[model samples]
Target: MMPKKAENCISCAVKLTGTGFTRFPCPDCGEVIGRCAKCRGQSNPYKCPKCGFIGP
Candidate 1:
């Protein structure tokens, strides 16, 4: 099954709001991943909570 979309930034656990936050599907598990502007700008690595898939 497709995983639910993440509500907060995966790397920082910050609430996603305003501009620059992104939501995309995990490459490995099709789970939605969330990234805040700061983390995305820094290229922080995020793990898919459902499948253990990590990406930067």
Candidate 2:
């Protein structure tokens, strides 16, 4: 089996690339989340899919 790659940016819905996405755990549930470089740089708000908690 292969490791799953990020499919899209959680904030902007942009297609993700190997070097353009950042992966981190959701603060509430510890679920992995993916954010694109552009959004991260711009401080775009992201919601946790597992808990619906929103944050920058």
Candidate 3:
């Protein structure tokens, strides 16, 4: 069993199951960002507020 952690989708800010999200390192910084499956499936663009980097 796994805990249901909450995480905000980087592309849409929707609350998603942490286990259902994807974590990747920011290209500009080493910080990690979380993207939900819905956003990733739709190729939604996301902007990293910390580094101002935008991408799908």
Candidate with top TM-score is 1
Q: After superposition, how far is residue 20 of candidate 1 from its true place, in Å?
A: 0.3
The parts of candidate 1 lying over 4 Å away from their true place are: 1-3
Better of 1 and 3 by lDDT: 1
**Cα displacement (Å) at residue 13, model 1:** 0.4
Off by over 4 Å in 3: 1-6
User: Ranking by TM-score, best first?
Assistant: 1, 2, 3
Could you give candidate 3's per-residue lDDT for residues 8-37 as a string of tens digits? 777777776755578776798655677898
**What is the per-residue lDDT of model 2 for residues 1-56, given as tens digits with 9 covering 90 to 100?**
32254477889878778686798887897767789999999989999777898988
Candidates in order have lDDT scores of: 0.90, 0.80, 0.71
Q: Cα deviation in Å at residue 39, candidate 2?
A: 0.3
- Reference-based lDDT, residue 5, model 2: 46
Better of 1 and 2 by TM-score: 1
Clashing pairs in 1: none
Q: How does residue 49 of candidate 2 score in lDDT?
A: 75
